[model samples]
Target chain A: MSSPDDKRRTIRDVAKAAGVSISTASNALNGIGRTNAETREKVKRVADELGFRPNALARGLLTKRSHAIGMLTNDTYGRLTLPMAAGVSEILVDHGVSLFLCATNNDPRLAKLHLDALLDRQVDGIIFTATRIDLEPPPELLKLGIPVIYAFAQGPADSVSFHPDDAQGARIAVQHLHTLGRSRILHITGEQNYLAARIRADAYRELAGPSGQVMFGEWSEEWGHSAIDTVYSQSGPKPDAIFCGSDEIARGVIDALRDRGVSIPDDVAVVGFDNWEVVSKQTRPPLTTIDMELKELGHRAGLAILGLSRREKLEPGIVRLPCSLVARGSA
Target chain B: MSSPDDKRRTIRDVAKAAGVSISTASNALNGIGRTNAETREKVKRVADELGFRPNALARGLLTKRSHAIGMLTNDTYGRLTLPMAAGVSEILVDHGVSLFLCATNNDPRLAKLHLDALLDRQVDGIIFTATRIDLEPPPELLKLGIPVIYAFAQGPADSVSFHPDDAQGARIAVQHLHTLGRSRILHITGEQNYLAARIRADAYRELAGPSGQVMFGEWSEEWGHSAIDTVYSQSGPKPDAIFCGSDEIARGVIDALRDRGVSIPDDVAVVGFDNWEVVSKQTRPPLTTIDMELKELGHRAGLAILGLSRREKLEPGIVRLPCSLVARGSA
Candidate 1:
């Protein structure tokens, strides 16, 4: 019996067993150029009998395509990146592509080093993801010939990018609340710095009209709690519904409302954004929120890059994917 | 002016400029075999100026070392695996090692395919992580010569494995509660099927003698809320301190207690496990809980694999990393 430590069978072993030259055996096994059908079959049979496995690196060197993707990101928490990566992987795997993950931590030098290293490895393409929106990918990455797709963030003006339709997501939430007869809707949101926060706030203003109460603060539960106090302290009537920037803020609003003897949905229907499962599902009465469909965005990005790799021309512009409302107990 | 599509400088370009043979230029650039010092310096200077990047796959084939690792995980949510991966990447990057990430999703065939692909790519070693602990790696992996380290899971009897010391973590939680002068400490945890749940329950019984209360159900927040009702319905004395199996459970307990007008850290103190930042920090009063030290476990696991890759002998057994206590407002 062969021991487990025995060296793996090599192509040379197949060649010797088949009584053929190394070049003939290699050509027959790889189906490179034309060869006799009988000889090719015999070489393949010999290789299978010996359990010979071809070296991917050698094949990649010869073909100039590694069939691997370099997935670069600064999102260490994997909040959006994880699902996005899963979608990308789902598409890429079916195409026989593997992903090499690297975190740049927003460090320019580290990003350059990683980019160079990945380029040296001859990856077929690259997918760049970020925690926040950016105007463009680093200039160094644009020069590389490999296909590049930016997901959950913007890239250069000439590059293709994917992101959620934040304005549309806000509209869906407001429409849902409106359908439930919640007119006096207060908009409580995070800081004005984030593009997402501003976009959603603008959407709320357009959809909920000029009289809608809009407050911007930190993206925290504490902010959500305090915003309620600020609203109630005002001279006008209290809100019958609240559209929060995030599930965290919504949780705080619900808790504060509950503490003040206000019943969820009956007294003040609440809606949140991001539909984060942990926070949205665990809240008392649960939470109805906007789902960004990040995975779908990533899946489209994967397909786009695969197309680019095949020399197919692609439109260079932002593709804003549609968002959906996940209705739960609260709203 | 250069367009974005410009090709990167190649070794042949460097050699042509340096007035030397390609073989000599390559030997000088890579510091391989014997080469004259003057020619080496000239080639290095020319190569740097041209930005000649070497092909890593070619170098790997020559050296028989890829300087890359395959990280195979089935943890799709990235709750534990992400932190572990970050730790692994930290060490690997410092040593000029790249990571190849693959999610097998508990499919034996998929796992085998990934393993073969990684091997074909000439990865130096492999790290296997899982959604839960298991007795051994897949039988297909056992035959490979590459070093394999199991993290947050178990491997074969003679292989190295790393996991959190669940029993010790429970001891820490119980001891902390005891230090707070809590006599009637109630333990509310998740399902009885989980190894972690069972280990913590056993530890609670040992440390609390015969008087401690232990309840097991779902790992959901709803379960925590209902368990409180069950406890108070037939109880002699209500628990002064509650130790929850997870932050979600603790959050429910805190919310329910607050609704009943129970002052946190005054009428009752609460502690939790997992120290999940989002849940723990967002509680009415932040939770004081046990942290599994997962990142550190991952860092150590990375180092262990690095050593193993270098053929250094390692102690073959489960290395139970100690968990730590993170104190906040609740306790």
Candidate 2:
């Protein structure tokens, strides 16, 4: 193992070893300027032998490209940010770009501090992300000269952003139940104040027409269990299918139905949103849920940001990525 | 809003505005060399007035301190790594240092690629983390000239590493059960091959003496549910308390016990490991579990890395952080 005192090989050493001027050595290695082809090859070979890796800091200074990007997020638990970050890293790493993740934890002061640090570091671009799409990023983000992209968060009207199509996802769930030959469908969702819940409820209402029943409650398994009692206690007719806003809620619904001695998909079929593996896969019969595809949204945003970093002209608008249904045992 | 075409204020500009030599201005702002206190204050005032932020890349070229660190992890799911990374960021950000996260996805080749990128960027240090402590990081990690600290992962014998004390955590759970006057205790855990499972089982055996029973199975809710049947179907004294290896297992055990008309803390008490809020809180009566304090381990690792970066003397060895029991209605 090399000691901390071991000095890294520098371009100067490579130049001396290759018997060329410093400028010629640099141009040859970079494959630019008016360096002769033969000299370039010789210098490159010498550099390879000497194990000369160009310092990113030095190279960034000359080219004005840091080859680094900053990701500012308010998702403290990483429920949404981590997968998105993984997708971003998947693309950025191949392009020799490193990502810096700054968790603001919803503190505007902390967010501003992190932003300043990123700007001072001369990051090529910045991607703002959050747990939900309704929240807007700091206004100062738009004023920054460098490129900016919003992922899983709302941005200004003239900015580029990506989020899942919640309404479309709701439609897919309702359609799946419809195809399964179920007419009475009930929507059990999270708090009405949440934009996602409102959007999903609206879509379900549109499809269910006048017969659709919507219940707004907490996004918890407890809520799902109680919702069953509230719906079944009524004398009219027990819904043949139930669409839950989240996997947690669906798990509860499935458990409640089982406790009541009702057979799943026969007495009542259950559909869920957010294909969270832990919750969706562990349910008694597993849950058929909607996947927001946050990772894919992040991948597209990464590519767009990379293009913008290279000064490519990109249209400014909101791009709603499609969500997919993960069919399991329940529905 | 500043346009991309607008030029950034440089040190030279600040120096000219302050009516001082560039070298003097640089020295004064940096608080070094023979610059007088009066000149230092004047230069700083002038720089601030010009909205001048020092370019970190240029500063790093001279000081060899990039004010950045890289974190390499194989935790693709981010279940464990995310909380640890958050703790790391919490400490490092306060010290004006930025963190770069490189996910290797357990691929050796990918790990090498990320390592090389971090080195090229001149990151002051690196932190290696993973989902488990038994797994060793790439051997190349030790050979890097920069300081490296292992968090939630094993390091070489003479290197620094941090992990939760599993045996201690198990003992705490068993002791809590004993305090509740539950003499007949059973330990139901995941696969025995896992170091954590074995250590925890060993601790339980030590505490329960001759009559302690342990069942090794998959780390899933299914195992917990079936293990109950396996235990009850036999003509033997049923355990009064169950210590689970994970929250999922505990949830399943609780559910099965409830289905069999068992009253929690009245007929049987359940304690779980890994204070995973989702599973622990959602359980019928909530769960009392052991918290590994993974985030605190990350926080301490971050502090240690910073100390190493500043050339502070730190002892190298394995540090086992204590796990605390989270009390709830279950036990």
Candidate 3:
């Protein structure tokens, strides 16, 4: 249904229709340069009548600001990137900024290629994001001479980055169980190699004191189901509460507890992390979990990058945004 | 670590280093206008040495091609968009094209705003995508004087659109079960209002014949679990296999069957649609599911849009890409 290219109106047409020179029309439309108030209003009215939209590319060439940014991410699955991107786009769209999302999928060569493409487009700024906070972006990003920020991803020590406060997320999960009068809290989590798992376990240990039990395994429901067996098999006081590292693990714990005829929040309260709706809400008794607030992290990252693009002075360091707990049926 | 902007190399620097005029250097580097082979080589060498990347905006003014495309999507959770985006990006990145993803969250005003932003940027093409294929894109998109394509989304009757062959996906799922010696197959699916669910049910009826049973319910694990009780409670001859409309429902069915002490594959084989890894792979005994091949659809859509941008003659119509079955432990 689109019209022919020749049918599309241009600024030249607006200028001719307004009985003004091209420069005068441009100035009036842009509200730049000295122009008579009557002439400026006349040109604007004519442009509006013609439904003329200014070309951002042409404006960018003159202003040296593209009003566009690029997001370099390694999160191909979009588990983290999606929410973060939603948050970033939410903020940037209001500012009339467009975002280019380039997924590298952890391939170094691909990352470099995407980075170069973004540079060729002359994006005002770039945000590097990934699945985990431990993963680092390409080192070349620092030397691009443009504003750069990290969201839910690691960067150089001095670079501006945003991350979820995993320690606090864990503390709250354990504290919630304690508040419910559950003392013997057990931490069922993922691999020790994961920084999140370690951070959460450390926080759980702090809250649960000497009676704390930490079971490290894969981030899976099967592991959660099996860990419950390992705990109940031991000749000791059974845990009154279980805080899982992920929603999947919590689902598994709930299923395993039901299989063993244990009542949820009655015999053992269950809590999870990442607040993944699909798994958390699907659980028999919906999971009480910690939300990483990835979107908020992205929002902050977007603002910081915009600030840097505007040459605003900002202290460079990692900023850990707070995580919030979503109370559900299980805890 | 980035150097000052004044230190950034430009075409002028390359021209000065190569001892040629700016236009000559540009022509040589772009391989556009006729330039002596030796001068072209010299300009290229100097440009490479100086790390002078050409500004796409400046080149776009002459070429009228931005080498950038925009993707307008309504898939907020990214359940469908992520894989599709990966496919689109996979094809575009190789073509040196950057993709701008704008999330509208189904708000008409937001969609219009993002659409305007894409148009203002002079993007070479636009792709409209959404979670469901039955939903229509904004009517204004059809009026834009540019090549537009739809991926995993619906557009005008004659527009170029790519969608998963739901009937084919369902047939394959059912055929796979039949091939496994499963007879009296039961089809448990989501809401009947969904075109996907209806199409899949029709396909199931075709393969399953008169004995085919269809259970319409919500697309959730709870539904799958409860549907099983409903089926067994009144059933005379239990089904040998169950074909679910989604992975979540299949997971619920598998869990409920396990609770009922029904031996999988031995008593009841189950097949699920939407090879969603989180649910299919995590289900007890895993799950054999049909993949929508959304990424492949994206790849084809990218290629089609690129072809249209190049003014290549392409037949405008809906193209239903095929689906494939992923074999796992459940079936």
Candidate 4:
């Protein structure tokens, strides 16, 4: 626990301790300029002894690499981007990199403004993220000379993209329910417009076969509660398990079922997608949901961009990360 | 809409249009070196006509002012900080100032690392934010020379601090419930250890008087659900209105009431604090809650730091911004 009064070891401190010029110390540390090997080794040793850390700014000026990344996002609510941002920051900070986060609010003009600003600041590279997946990068971002990595979203066909595997997440949820001896399962999810909803539904159908029921509605708790009526009204046997597209919908379903005198995981088991902690963890029986590994996606995105910045070879195209089931009390 | 192909006007463009050397144009625009008044005026006109935006990086080299600020927070989830971040960005972007965001994740070592990094980057100022209120800045941030502003949290006694008025928010929630002609009101909130919970509870007592029942518990939906049992078990008349500390608790309360066949508004109206959109707006009846105006606090913090950077006079104390009621179906 170093006190605030404990001044950080600066290049000046290292120079003073090594009895050398600041530039000599800096050149010695960075392996540039005309410094002798013996002097460089001595400077390095002194720097290490004093815990002297070179300022990235001074290093960046010589290398033309700011070691800072611009993270452009349009996720205003930060529902998806926050975790991704956290994950990206988690890895980048260790490399003496900082993040410049910009929210474009999905406006092309705003996006361009942010892009230009970040470029003017001379960020090492850019990582563009979104709340949902897209097939291509924005038209303006296509020609950027700097490296770009898309996380929780897609970029151009040839660009590196990272996103959650919704199909696998759906499979995990359904398989978990099946292992619990629940055969009559119903899939109630968000609107059909979302690619995630469709992918999850497709996976559910393939795994559950003809007996599975799939209903698409808005991603709202109200819809989740109302869908219960439609499920019970069908002529066939009532579903013994329900898989919701989102935690919000799952919460609604759980509450509505409980209100009807049905015991969770006793009369029926329910599972959800996007194991959102605030909602999933607070549910009556808590929620057994799919963890999208968004943070991990972010972590990979950070590493991929760093690699690209160093001109390291990387595979392009969409890279779907795995999703797994988070077992809680509900299932 | 302007196409992405339309490149932003540069100083070179202005110089060419004004028929002056690049050095002369730079001197005139920045008001540096030897430049005649007529030439400076001519350059200014040409620059204005061309919509020339000065390169901050270039200007930074001479003035040592990057016009950049670092926003450091420990709120990894970004639940409270996102809106504040958005608000800060909203104000600072217009001034051509960019933000460097770092999440410390409540690690003192990480906090020190981030602070040192930001300082090394030569940021003009720093804004320290947190998930909860603190009486002072972290021990590591005490001695930084650059301007520092606190948002959604407090810093040193002499620094400008901006935070939500929890007491005012509680007053507004209580007053709204009272105006609805609901006398038997109960305050069900989170743990008493939280400063927010205590302030809000104090305000509730003053506004609702001695009769106002206050129950302190965990900040969870489960607590909200279980509190209903405690309230109903009492011999006296049931509460006609419930004011919750957070929207999560309100959602639980609303759901529990609905399950018990108690009609919302007609039987018991509910109000909540922190008008969290995802939780409040998605509630069954939609929660009427106290809007803490956290974004506004962030905006103010940004402005205060900008002002301080310019050596402008500002009062040093905890500035509590007023909270307002957001009327919805719940109350």
TM-score of each: 0.93, 0.97, 0.97, 0.91
Steric clash pairs (candidate 3)? none
lDDT of 1 at B176: 93
Instruction: Point out where model 2 deviates above 4 Å.
Output: A1-5, A34-36, B1-5
Which parts of model 3 have CA positions greater than 4 angstroms off? Answer: A1-7, A33-36, B1-7
* Per-candidate local distance difference test: 0.85, 0.91, 0.90, 0.86
Top of the candidates by DockQ: 2
TM-score of chain A of 4: 0.90
In the range A1-331, model 4's lDDT, one tens digit per residue, is 3466356578898999999999999899989999999999999999999877665555665566888899999876777888888889888989988898888878787788888888777788899988878544577787776789988777887889998999999999999999999999999999898888999999999999889889999998888999997776668678899999999999889978987788998999999999899989988898999999888988999999899888897998888899989999999
What is the per-residue lDDT of model 3 for residues B102-181, given as tens digits with 9 covering 90 to 100? 99989999899999999888899999998887886889898788889998888897789898999999999888888888
Candidate 3 chain A TM is: 0.96
The residue ranges of model 1 lying beyond 4 angstroms of the native Cα positions read A1-5, A15-32, A36-46, A135-139, B1-5, B10-12, B19-39, B134-137
lDDT of 2 by residue, A1-331 (tens): 5565477889999999999989999999989899888999999999999878999999998899999999999877777888889889878998999999999988888898899999988999999998877887887798888999999888998899988999999999999999999999999999998888999999999999899989999999999999998877878878999999999999889988998899987888899999988899999888999999977987998898899999998899988889999999888
- Give the docking tier of candidate 3: medium
Most lDDT-accurate candidate = 2
Scored by lDDT, model 4 comes in at 0.86
Q: Which pairs clash in model 4?
A: none
Q: Arrange candidates, best DockQ first.
A: 2, 3, 1, 4
**Angstrom error at residue A40, model 4:** 4.7
Q: Chain A alone, TM-score for each of the models?
A: 0.90, 0.95, 0.96, 0.90
List the candidates ranked by lDDT, beginning with the highest: 2, 3, 4, 1
User: Which candidate, 2 or 4, has the higher TM-score?
Assistant: 2
